[model samples]
Target: MTRRPSPPQSTLPSDPILALRANELLARGRQLESQGKIADAARVSAELVNVAPDLAEAHQFMGSMAMRTGAADIAAMSFERALQLKPRSADLHIALAQALLALQRPADAARILDKGRTLHPNDAGIFRELGQAQLDLGQPDAALKSFSRATKLVPNDLYSRHMASALATTGAPNPGYVAELFDSYAGTFDAHLTGKLEYRVPQALAAALAEHGPVAGPTLDVGCGTGLVATTLPETLRPIDGIDISEKMIAKAQERGVYRHLRTGDAHAVLADEPDFAGPYGLIVAADVFIYIGDIGDLFASLAARLAPGGILAFSIEFNEAQGIAIRSSGRFSHSPAYIHGLAAANDLSILAEVSHPIRLEREIPIPGRLFLLRRG
Candidate 1:
């Protein structure tokens, strides 16, 4: 008689009690991760790993926990270990690739996934992550191919949509799409953005203001998000005003009681309508605002008309090349230093100082930003 086939190795419970404890711990770990308690999740997952050393799920959780804590090396180690236990798990391979990508080892990530694709040929998630790895490696063409496959596999994927849009606009003109994306997410702006991103636009603007002389008159806080910058201003700066395109944001700013006047309006148009704005504002501040406005010519002209002679204008801009301003598929605009200088000179403003820093984002990714201080000539 033929011998009965051995039971699947992965089906073993090791011990019923141990399996029950591992399950309980894993559930708690997931809940903690959902609550953004990454440290706690890691701790729980570590316990689960001890109880169920061969469990791929436990190792995957540990990898995710490590990544949340900025422990990329540890995350990579955890993912690699998990892959060894579940060599056929496509999700684990993708997770491993992400960890490798974070460690700036795109070539290694690509190699890992190249093997994974052969083992699990139809996995869309793997292709999507492969695209990201290629993008990180400065191989946009390869990225496009992988992203294309991902979109075909899962048409409604937002991440894939964003990636595709980004690739399409790599060398294209400002198509006015990024603003729409921001406007759509304007409602949940502060809830998802604030501390998670370590956002400190107000602090940066305040520092820029301090470097210049005191604000002798009223001030304008342009694109004032939740009045963060407004509340940070010194009490000596009387009649601080704020303007933004989102009424919901202005309403939130109003709750802070920082601005003497808070209006919901377009920044470019607001200055033009107030033809007599000269004496009211000795300073105009735009923190993390210009990224949405592609053409600074009209905005600068409007600002120049509104400023008192020798009045200072302070703002932050995301940098791009001097030769061109490309609107990314995300619809956000990036400007070059040369473009900024041109706008300042045309508007009769002299650049006093410029400082570059990593701007905080809600997802913990930092983007490059420049703070500029200009005096009306």
Candidate 2:
């Protein structure tokens, strides 16, 4: 007769020795994870689960590992199991919500975050996560309220406070906020922007440049998110330099191998970094970049100083033509033609061409905007 092995335990033990051993195993697993030994950590966690199946920490470790591997569905299952074992764990709730969001279940993530908020009313992190979920779910009004409540809970938290205030007022978005937004968004930026948002600014800019017949010079693309602008350029066009605030965005653009160089920093600060390049670029582009910045005088002055004489500066802006500058509810800045052209004139740049170029789709209607090409004196 063959001997049969015992089935694995389905429940944790209450015995002193078993409990102590389980704790030791869990601690070892966590230590391995802390040391960046993910495989070792996973093996240890599996051992812990085999010995003590109801251990939430083991499940949580597996959940985190799954998340890091981009197995969001597995992560969600592990987190849900952990939640069943430890229903009151706020951190588990957050992890589960994050997995759900990554899985494209923003509404479900919002629900999980809401449950977390009910348990921990003062947890600003939960509120922030909830707000993000709401925003992704197209409930911007609800997101604004959640963000406001988060800032109220933690007054000194610059990110939540900035987002809350920026959502409520007409002001330029903080550069850090813009960078942080895009850093998290980099994974889906190209697909979401081009396919869903109907963004054609980069292609439009290329076509506009092409009208000038094989335009070529030392060029710079400000806020070159994923370097989509490079696709529209003529073969004769130079490998343009690029700058962006988000390191993730810069990395994505680098993978495209289009730019002469890519830099991660504030676009305003990059404007001042003369050592990063030769004297001045003959063509400077701000394709959809100025939407994050309201006041243009300072930027125009910097562009004028950095553009060689007779060099070109091309850019785009969302315009309603009602005000010199307006901050939309979406937290983007829009400017009127008067505002941009005034700055160009004040900076001694001549507007060579201005065309109505609407790119983004809102409720199936194109958003009003303009693309302008200017020349330095």
Top lDDT prediction, candidate number: 2
Worst 10 residues of 2 by lDDT: 4-13
Scored against the true structure, residue 27 in model 2 reaches a CA lDDT of 85
User: On a 0 to 1 TM-score scale, where does candidate 2 land against the true structure?
Assistant: 0.60
lDDT of 2 by residue, 1-377 (tens): 99986533335568878888888988887788889887777777767766777878778888887776557887899899888888788898899998888777888998999899999998888887887788678675787798899888987665666556655654545556788888999999999899877999988887787775345667888888888886676656575888888999999999987788788987767767747644377788888888876676776787777887788888999986767876554557779998887888888898888999995975345779999998887
Top candidate by TM-score: 1
- lDDT at position 224, candidate 1: 82
Tell me each candidate's TM-score. Answer: 0.74, 0.60
lDDT of 1 by residue, 37-86 (tens): 88999999899888888887888899999988888888899999888878
Off by over 4 Å in 1: 1-12, 34-37, 88-90, 112-128, 144-163, 170-201, 236-238, 245-248, 260-281, 291-306, 318-335, 361-368
